[model samples]
Target: MLSMLKRIIIGAPLKSTELGEQKLNKKKALAILSSDALSSVAYGPEQILLVLVTISAVAFWYSMPIAVGVLFLLTALILSYRQIIYAYPHGGGAYVVSKENLGENAGLVAGGSLLVDYILTVAVSVSAGTDAITSAFPGLHDHNVIIACLLVVFITILNLRGITESASILAYPVYLFVLALFILIGVGIYKIITGDVSSDLHAPIGTPVAGISLFLLLRAFASGSSALTGVEAISNAIPNFKEPGPRNAVRTLMAMGLLLAILFSGIVFLAYYFGIAPKHEETVVSQIAAETFGRNFMYYFIQGTTAMILVLAANTGYSAFPLLAFNLAKDKYIARMFTMRGDRLGYSNGIITLGVTSILLIIIFKGQTEQLIPLYAVGVFIPFTLSQTGMLVKWLREKPKGWAVKLAINLTGALISFLVMMMFFITKFSQVWAVLIFLPLIVLGFHQIKKHYVAVGDQLRLTTCEPIKPIEGNVIIVPVAGMTHVVENSLNYAKSLSADQIIAVYVSFERVDEKIFEDKWNKWQPDIRLVTLQSYYRSIIQPLTKFIDTVEKKASESNYRVTVLIPQFIPKKSWHNILHNQSSILIRTFLLYKRNVIVTTVPYHLKK
Candidate 1:
């Protein structure tokens, strides 16, 4: 039943040849990889308003300028990442670029930062998605955490199946969300131009708390910068694209940037022009829709599409984290299990890990986007700076053809990103300082893992090519309880390997049983000799294990090999296994640990 469920969800185990069938082209890759950035518009502008509305009216007016600044940063990032795609076509992203240009330590820092970013992406995206639903259906407010967790679980299952499958499933919702936003923008603009101002425009007069400060406005820009968190994911997953993977990934990245720029501009513009202020209860986007369309069907359509894309936006993180882990594992920085693919040709372990971590974050933060927001961009922009700086270094040092143009783009991106990072760093220090300690520890962990792999390789190196020892005689030891068909079957097979030293050992705790077994053995007169030993402790495996140890020492002295054969009964039904007492199983379990000792389980099929 479990296997069937697994088969249905993740699909049947796929052959290595079918991998090409699973690769996504650029058109599909854009929808799958850009969900986070695209859906982020649902809350990114809202976050800016939330920060601004708490201050004075003058600060509230600053939202447009801040949005423009963010747009400039967004443009710089897209151009820099396109260069990243062309230079490191095999999904180098930030970690590889930083590693190659800076050092292994810098690479680890970038990797650790991205790990945190991917996890928070899932958490924040799901939380915001749930928030979108509760805005429309207020009764869901109490169950936000549960709903958010379920959304993460759903996305995780989709991702575990395969990228192409997930892309096809989610592409429609992304298109729908984009469509809904454009409709909202276009309609809102028409209404504003016609002088049909929303009757519900209630721009509240701000009672200033710490009046009109530059720091507060910068903090607002930093808060809204979360929209840019997912832009690097495409470059990280270039290998998953169809042929010409890098070119396809670059196209997807460009398409995503253009869509984000348009959506962000529309949402921020509508929010300001429509007199939509951050409400404690409703989202800024929803309010813009309601004020523009007056709680009509179009408003709900916008909310519905927004909810869907927001929940599904987590797909971006699911795609990025697993492949990043695969890369880290490839370099021996993480566990090799992460490098293994699942039935769907996806990094199943890493996907499942991201899901579990996101669920924990959801539960911890109570699925509140505001609570999770403070921890978001620090992880994101650190990688942004590193990637841009790495590319800058790459261009300057290598001076490849056309390097001058690339260097200017990356340097501008790095400088802008570094400045924005400082804005978040000073304004939100208490919120993100834990990362300062967390990142270094993770880098040390990478070094430790690399060290462990190196140590294991050194220990397992072939030191000598000579035969194991001076002797070459191979001996097989069969442990039998008494004369039965089970014993007969084992000896018959043991005879085929070598008749030289096939010893059958019998362990008896009492004389009465030993004599009965001895009489039966003698009566049957099996060709192989039987050796009996008495144990006062009533232990069968302990005595037999000691005997095997002694034989192993003698075999080593003679350069001989030792094999232990144990016969097992095959029950017709699983419950029938409980009917019989198992001693050979106990024997095989212990004997397997001894060096140079071979343990084999030969099953005797019972017709009944």
Candidate 2:
């Protein structure tokens, strides 16, 4: 039943071969990969206004300048990641760039940072999407965490169907959201130019430049820079694109960048122009839509699409995190389980892990984007700085064509990214202390996993070992409670394996009378020797284990291998397992860790 349900949810896992080389064109790729960056405009501009509004409604006008600063950062990141897409076409992004140029430690740090960032991306996206929906339908205001978690589960199921399927299913909402935002922007711009304005807008605030401190403005920029979170995703996701993946990826990167710049800059401009404050009941984007379209059909339409694409933006992390973990697994920095693609050729383990983690974050924070935002840019920026520095070193060392130009671009980008990272730390460090501890722990985890894999590889190495020889000789010991068909069957199999002695031992705990069974056994005339062990403390396992140890000690001096064969009864129904004893399982668990000791069980089916 679970298997059938799984088949229904993820549309049955596809064969590994079926996952080969199918590509996403510009449109589909944009829907799946660019959703994170594009959807950020929903909260990014509002995050700035949220910070500014703390001082007064008068401080709200500063949002325009703060947003401009974030725009500059966005421009630099877009150019930087475009170069990354060209250079690291295979899609490791920061980890690959840093590992090859900087060293293993740097690579692990980048990998760890990305690991945290991608996860937080999903958490933040889903929460903000829920916030968007609740803004539209106030009745859902209290259930944000539940709805957000359900959305994460739904997205996981969609992605489990494979990359292409997810792209197709998610593209419509993303495209529609983009269209609605553009139309809203156009109409708002026309209203500004042609003297047509909404009467519902509250009068504008006028906080002079002298009233605002540089620190306050910088903090707001740091907050709004969340818009830049998903830009490098394209560089990290070249493998998911169509033919000429790097080329297609660069085009998508530019398209997503242009869209983000337009939407972020336009939304902030309109919000400030209309004097829209960050309201607790609705979003700045929703407020802007209300001002532009005035609660009409287009207004609700825009709100619905906004909620959808914001939710769908989680697909970016959904696709990227598993692929990044797959690379880490291949490098032996994480468990091999992350490398195991499912029937759909997706990293099923990583996908499920991502989903569960995101849901936990939502529950912990109560689906509040404000709380999660401070934990955001720390992870996001570390990889940016590392990737740019790695590229700077690469350009200087390789001195490729246009290396000078590339070096300057990367150097400037690295400087700017470092500054932004420090700003994020300084301004939001109180909320981000967890990230400081979290990233290093991830790096330590990477090292520990690497060590374990290395040890396993060493132990499994066959080059220095001798070839196999014959079993030499076998002495089989059968543990028998009494003579029964189950015991008779096990003894016959043990007899086939033993070259010489077949000893059938009975452990007695004073509960069973075995003299009658002994007489019957002797009457049956079996060739096996019967050894009886008595335990005064009513313990069967202790005496049986001691007897096996004694035999093992004796066998070590000879060329014979020791085997303990036990009989087991199989229940007709699974629930019948509760009625049976589990001695075989206990013995097998003990023998598993021993060297050159074997334990086997023969099962006899029960009729009742």
RMSD of each: 3.9, 3.2
- Model 1 scores a C-alpha lDDT of 0.86
Q: How many clashes would you count in candidate 2? A: 1
Which parts of model 2 are misplaced by more than 4 Å? 138-142, 198-207, 465-471, 477-489, 499-509, 513-525, 529-546, 564-587, 599-608
Model 2 lDDT at residue 258 = 86
How many collisions per candidate?
2, 1
Winning model by lDDT: 1
lDDT of 2: 0.84
Clashing pairs in 2: 14-343
376: Cα error in model 1, Å: 3.3
TM-score for all predictions? 0.86, 0.90
lDDT of 2 by residue, 1-608 (tens): 66788788887666656755446788899889989989988888888988788777667777777777777777778888899888889998899999999999899998898887888889988887888788777899999999999999999988888888889899999999999999999999999889787634533445364457788787888788877887878887788888789999999988898899999999988988888888877788888888788889999999999989888889999889988998999999998999898878888898999999989988888898667776776787888999999999999899999888888888888987898788888988888888778778888999999999998887778864656455667778888877678888887777676357788888776645656666677777467787788888976778888888888888867767888887887887877787778878887788777687788888888897
User: Residue pairs in steric clash, candidate 1?
Assistant: 471-558, 471-559
